[model samples]
Target: MNFLYLLVVLLPIAFGVGWWASRRAVAQRSGVQVSELSSDYFRGLNYLLNEEQDKAIEVFLRLAEYNHDTVETHLALGNLFRRRGEVDRAIRVHQHLVSRSGLSDAMKTIALLELGEDYVRAGLLDRAESLFSDLVAMKAHAPSALRHLIAIYQHERDWHKAIEHARRLEAMTGEDQAPTIAQFYCELADRSRQHGARAEAREYLQRAFACQPACVRAFMLTGQLEAEDGHHAASVDAYEAAIEADSAFLPGILPPLLASYARSHQMDRAEKFLRSLLDRYHGVSPVLALTRLYRQRDGERAAIDFLTAQLRQRPSVRGLMALIDATMDKVEGEAHENFLILRDLTTKLLEGQAMYRCSRCGFGAKAHHWQCPSCKSWSTIRPIHGVASE
Candidate 1:
C-alpha cells in the first residue's frame, strides 16, 4: 500500500519534470534531444518505482549533467541521495551546484543549506557548523540556519549556544520558545550541579524559572540543591512545588520527596500529601508510599487494611506484591513456599517493563529521562501509568 502511494505521489512530479525538460529542449530547437530526455526521465522514474535507487540515481545524474541550468533537477537529485543515506553523493551534487558561476543567490543559499545537512548526516559537525553559521550571518535563510545551529549545539552539548540560537529563532518567528529555553537552562544547571558549582547551578535555575515560571525540571533541581545542603524543609517545599508543577513526574519525585519528609520529621505532612494525591493522581506510587508510612507509623495490621482497601479500588501488581510481603511472615511451610513463588512471579512480571515513555514519540525506557533519547524532546518522558507501573 505504501509503495503504491509513493508511486502515485511521484508520478505527478515525474510528469512535471518531463514537461519542463521537453520545453527546455524545444527552446533549444533539439527535437531528438526532447525525445531522448523524456525517455531517460521515464526510465529513471521506472527504476525509482521498482526500488532500484542506484540505477535511478545514475539516470537522474545524467539528466542533471546534460542540463546544467536545471537547478531544481540537481536539488531533487541531491535530496534523493540524502534520503538514500548516500551523504557523500548528496554533498557532491550540492557542492557542484554551489560552485556553479551562473547559479542565482537564492539557489546558492538553498544548495548551501542542503550541503550543511549533508555534513550533519556525515558526522562532519565542524563543517556543518561553519556552513550554517555563514547562512545565519548572511541572513539568507536565518531561521532554518538558526534551527540547524541549535540542533548542532545541542548535539555538541553546547547549552549556551543552543539557548542563544533558540532565542534568535523565537525573535525571528514570533513564537513562544520559553519552554524550550527553560529546558536548555536546566541542562546547564545540571552540568553545573554535577561539577559542584552550586551557586552557578542556582543561577541557571533562576534563569530557567524566569523563562518558565513553573518549570518542573527547575523545581526538581531546586529540591536537589536544597537536599544537598541538608535543608530538608526547603527540599520538601521545592519537591512539593515540583509535583504541583507536573504531577506526571510523581514516580521520580515521590521517592526523594518522601526522604525529605522523613528527614524533616514531617510524616504528618507526608500522609496528608499522599492522601491528596490519591484523590488527584491515579498511579500506585502514592498508595505504596502511604502504605509504607502506615506500616512504619501505625502497625502491620493498619498498613495491610489500608493496602487491601486501596488494592480493591485500584488493581496493581506492585500493590499485590507489597500486600504479599506484608502477610508472608504469617504463613509457614507450604503456604510460605507458595507466597515466595507468587512474589517471584510478580517480580518477573515487573522486570524489564518500561516504567516511562515519551509522550511525543512513544519511546519506552526502563528509567526516566529529562529528554527522550529517541526524540530528544525535553520533559516528554513521563512515568508510565498502569497496573504494573506507577
Candidate 2:
C-alpha cells in the first residue's frame, strides 16, 4: 500500500518533468514559446492518438488559430483533413493559401498542387487537370504537374493528350518514358484500327516500335492489322517476332499467329512454331494448341490420349472440361449423366474466376488488357494460368 502511494506521488512529478522536456523540444523546433499552446496541442494529440476524431478536429482547429501565420501548420492540418477524406476542407484550406497575396510563388505552387490532389480525391478531375496544366505551363513544379496531367488524360481515355504530355515530361525531366510512350502509341493504333483507319494505325504502330525497339504491343498490332487486311504472310512474321520479344505474351500472340498461318495454308510452319512455343512456355495454351494440332492430323482418339497425358502433368480445370467433353460423346447411361454434372460444376467453378491479372497492381479481370486499367501500367495485365483457372 505504501509502494502504491509512492508510485501515485511520483507519476504526477514525472508527467510535469516530461511536460517541460516536451516544451523544450517544441521550442527548439518552432523557435517560439510553445509552452502557452502546449496544453491544447497535447490534448489534441491525445485525442488523435486515442481515435477521438471529433475532439481531435476541434483541437487542430484551435491550433490553426493559435499558429495562423505558420505555413507548416496549415499544410499539416489540410493534409490531415485530406487523409481523413474531408477533401472539401482540404481544398478550402489549400485554396486560401494559394490566394494569399504575399505568399511565395513556390509556396503558392505547393498549395495549388495540394488543392489539385484534393480535387482528384473528390473526382473533380476537370478542375484538377486545369490547375495542374497551369502549373506545368508556368514551369513551377512542372514535372509533378505534367505527371498529374498525364494521369488525368489516361483516366479520361484521352490517349493523345497523355502521349503529348508524357513526351513533354520526358523532355523536361530527362527520365526514360519510352515504355509508357510506346503504350500510348499502341492505344492510338488500336483506336485507329477499330475506326477502319488502317494506314494510320500502322503509322502509330511504327512510332511505338521506334520508341521501344522490341515493343510486344506494336508487334501484336502489326500482326492484327496484317491479318485483318489479308496479308497472312506478314502477319505470321510479326506474330512470331512478338513471341520472340516476350514469350509471356504467347497465349495472346499464338492464337493469332496460328490463325494467320492456317489462313496462308502454312501447316508446316504452324507445327514448327507451336512446338517451339511449348519448349519456351510452361503455360497450358501451347499444350492445348498442340493437342488440337494432333487431333486435326491424327484423330479424336489421338487428341484425347494427348490431352490426358498433358493434364496429368499440368492438371487444369479447363483441360479437364475439354477432356470430359471429348469423352462424353462415347459414354453411355449413368456415366454420361455423371459427366454432365461434372461439366456443370466445372463450368460454375470457372464462371467467377478472373482469367487475367494486372502484374503491376494485382487487379483481376475476366478479360485480358494490354494496359492495366487500375494502375495504368502497360503490358501488365496477363493470363492467370493455374489449376482451377485460365
Pick by TM-score: which candidate is best? Answer: 1
Off by over 4 Å in 2: 1-33, 42-55
Winning candidate number (lDDT): 1
Per-residue lDDT over 89-195 for candidate 2, one digit per residue giving the tens place of the 0 to 100 score: 99989888888788888788899899999999999999999999899888899999999999889888898899999999999989999999999899899999999
Superposed by TM-score, candidate 2 places the C-alpha of residue 333 at a distance from the truth, in angstroms, of 1.1
Q: How many residue pairs clash in each candidate?
A: 0, 0
Q: What are the Cα lDDT values of the candidates?
A: 0.92, 0.85
Report the CA-based lDDT of candidate 1 relative to the real structure: 0.92
**Taking the tens digit of each residue's C-alpha lDDT, what string does model 1 give over 334-360?**
999999999999999999999999999
Please report, as a residue range, the 10-residue window in candidate 1 with the lowest summed lDDT: 17-26
